[model samples]
Target: MKKTILSILIGLLVVCFAGIVSADGIETGIYYEVDVSFDDDVEPGDSFDVEVEVTNIYNQNGTYVDIEDINVEVVIKDIDDSGSDDLDDDDDIDDLEYNVDDSIDFEFEIPLAVDDQSYDIYVTVEGDDENNGTRYTETFNFTVNVEKKRHKLMMKEPVVNYETLKCSRTTEVSVTLWNIGTSDEDVEMTVYNTELDISEKSSFDLDAGDDEDDIKTRRSFVLDLADAAAKTYTFYVKAEYDDGDERETEPFTLKVEDCPTEEPEEEEVTIVEEPTTPVITTPAVVEEETFMDQYGAALLLGLAYLVVIIVGVVLVIRLKKR
Candidate 1:
């Protein structure tokens, strides 16, 4: 009976040792050492990289065991949110020989809405042993601190009442400014065109709030192109705030055209004339005489002489004939 009891105790001890070895993977010879590297001062709304180096360890028998189908994954856990991102190109290794080290890079972007605080980054390495096909998983994590900039300004696309303006005309230019930083700001907005020789400025205050209305402000300027020439003009809207922190919108174009000239209208005219009076002419008086009355006496005397001569000639001719 005493020998049987001792043998039973020994068997029980052996069983417990085997369970420990199996649980710790000492017998399977699939162990790994992990090293993670990253930046400590991570900012919100920024992307960072975490490099993991996984080294395979030999078994308890002092023999090298190959690991196959190795995969590395990474996740970020904040106070209120958690997310996982895909690893870089070299995220997995087909086979890792004994005592060899492999590395993978994981890129994570901090959400813009994330608070400025500490975040936990968890890295998991998983693989299978080639000889026994036993799967092994190891997890590691580290903390990252996030901070925000105190003076940051963002300018949205400017809205213009007229993209194409006529010369000697006025246009209304409006833009919205956002205070995305941590502190309130006194913003100075300017709308300028160098070629047009125009510069207009306005000032306002913005609160550092996450809401739309609290952190946003709109400003408008009346750009008078009265003296501007007719051509393509490049204009820029800039915001200056919070100790020389400046932000500018992308350059926008405005086409200024010559004002159209209207032609003069023709007018019809009517001419009025005064009535003319008739002119009276006087008649001239002249003495009137008959043609026969004036020459009657003279003609009678001449006729008498001619008759006497004719009578004499006739008598002479009659005597000669007898």
Candidate 2:
């Protein structure tokens, strides 16, 4: 047992040494060629898609061996700086393996978040060596722009008016959408209320227009309000076009007002060949009066006395006898 343990430890050291140390400085049967295709100019805060293909070009065990499976990771650096030889984060690389049945190709996805005017993306591919425990590393570089992070979702009627029992209420709102992608593409949009619980915002189809109206997408919502207050409800609009997607547009709030409800129906009774009594609605008394109303009413009362004086013959006779 001791001998077996000793043998395993020795083997581990040998493997670890073999992984990074080659007379040629880490030679492995696995090789990677990474190619990227993206929009030429990515605008600040724009979005673009990146596709990476890693081809294995080598042979193993006297047989022509191809990289069966490998995972590639991407790192973004300042345009002025080059990436480090060592990985920044351990999770930068994904674990991938090639099985006898699955030995064909290796693929992976990564996103580039553009925070600067321009940046460089470094891609690293790691794979297992069949003969030894050595790990083969391959790298590729690409340039990115802040414009690539530029993405927008436009809402025409951001604030929807909701109907209520009070007059002067409104709630239905509609909006138009656009791809805004550097390339012509379709995006999935999600809408949700931050304060109030609302139905999930659904996806809409948008395309970058070549002709008029080609870049526009139309969508609408009937925002509902149960209360009679003018409080604001915030909604979140986020879009994800495809793989390597991210979010934008911090949650924004929209003020909504209550809409008036429909008037009640009037029920009428019918009589055949006979006149029907009219439905009498009593006049509502005005309890609250403005200053002008009170002044006008006092003026009319004073005018009544003046009219009595003009027709004062009967009143004067009664007053003289008294």
Candidate 3:
């Protein structure tokens, strides 16, 4: 029994030694690449995403190999102007598992809340490659650059010189803008109406300052009300800066009234009688035409008068002979 136990112990030691040799050989064949990228135009007090692509390559016995399973973790360090090595307050990402062949991607979000200045982010990626339960830990370090942030552009309520406008007329709309940040801003103002035509104010430079009066810059937009109707018109104003900063103001409204109408002129009139009345002749008999034609016609009266005159003359002659 003692001899058998000794032989089993020797066999176990040999198997352990073989695994150690295989791990050593595979470590030399393992290779990886780290690529880091983030937004370069990120502003202060804003959040942005950073992407890291980790690619692992392995070859054993002169043939390409694939890692059956792996786990990845990341640590972020925000380096100030003065470099420091301590990472007590740094951000740490938990472990994630994946089956990797050639490459894998990891994404993280970074929120910046500091002054408008340049900064650097250091990232450390820790991962393990497991092939048949043999684990190899791989680590890579990379740096990302963050540029200076620009200030915000602010706009006040717009003003209109005229309270009301008439059709086929033009007016001006005034607006003031301020650079409320740390740097100067090149601003352009655009003014538009839903029912009227207006021109924009462009290319105005403004400097930042603590006092509101010093930093304020005003511009005027010409609004033409030609062919506009009689109603209220709202003008929307938007201010854009050189660094893609934008601000919009509340709608400014103006009234349009119809012009007064003029009275028409009156001309002299003349009345003249017609030379002859218009007669309507028909084929019906005169007696059936009207009541006056049946009783008071001129032709019938002339015959009755002739008969009376002849009777009177005969009676006078007969009286003279008797």
Candidate 4:
């Protein structure tokens, strides 16, 4: 009976020790659960958000235990030929009570050089028990799908010959379109300014390739500002491809000024007058007296006196003879 009682006591002691060891060796008192949310269709060279909902259910010794110094982090693994990136750690969560939950957002940007493939995303949650200072960590992972559009058209910045234009003048505007998609595309380019009532469009085919010359096409247009006002005008360049998809460039500005005033021209006048006839006049004639006309009158008076004297002499001669 003594040996049986000793064996029974040894068995009881072994069971109690095992129980104590099992209770002390509990891996964690904090439970972690996560819910992830993201976009279904992801693309390269795009910025997106990944929302994570974290819940903590703390239970220790049949009692609720609070956790403190909580931190959350996120990392995106590299895909084929793509690079990896890490989000900043969110350590502002000081403590979490039993059955409490919180949400975090991780903003991510895919590299422009990434390929069309799936990538892995990792989320880690770490904290410590407030009572015993035991560290607890949990990690969760998910996948993100990345794909590129089959037909994508992009417009480069427009090359304008003049930023400021004069009224009744013209400007040359040129732009280039790029086929950055996976296949060849037929592109339609348009440059327009609704306020100025100016619109121009052209169509061309572009071969899809990585080379700059292979995938790009250029077009030029001359814009007449004959009826434009003297205020600011905005121009836009748009590209349409693959039957419905389109892209537009940033707004370009062109300022118009009023044309200068022109001075009036003076008229020339010619004066003409008929020719005048000259007058002619004749002078009167007066003859001057000669010397013989004056002497003829004196000679006639003397000859009359001489004839009377001769007659007296003849009478005297006749008286003497008687």
Give TM per candidate: 0.53, 0.32, 0.35, 0.51
Q: By lDDT, highest first, what's the ranking?
A: 1, 4, 3, 2
Scored by CA lDDT, what does every candidate get?
0.70, 0.49, 0.55, 0.70
- Residue 306 local lDDT, model 4: 85
Model 3 scores a TM of 0.35
Q: Candidate 1 has what TM-score?
A: 0.53
TM-score of 2: 0.32
Per-residue lDDT for 139-158 in model 3, tens only? 44433443443567667788
| Of 2 and 4, the candidate ranking higher by TM-score | 4
Q: List model 2 lDDT by residue over 1-322, tens digit each.
A: 9999999988665443322321111222235444455554554323445555455554456554434235556554542112222213222333333322211222222222112344555556667665464676665555654443234434333433442323433355454554444455556556666456755465645544222265566665665545426676666655556542644333545565556568999999896787789999999997998887769888888899989887797788889999
Question: Order of candidates by TM-score, top first?
Answer: 1, 4, 3, 2
Worst 10 residues of 1 by lDDT: 20-29
In terms of TM-score, which candidate is strongest? 1
Q: In order, what is each prediction's RMSD in angstroms? A: 18.5, 29.5, 18.5, 24.2
Which tens-of-lDDT digit does each residue in 51-137 have in candidate 4? 876777767778987878888776677642334443333534548888787877778776544555666666667888888999877
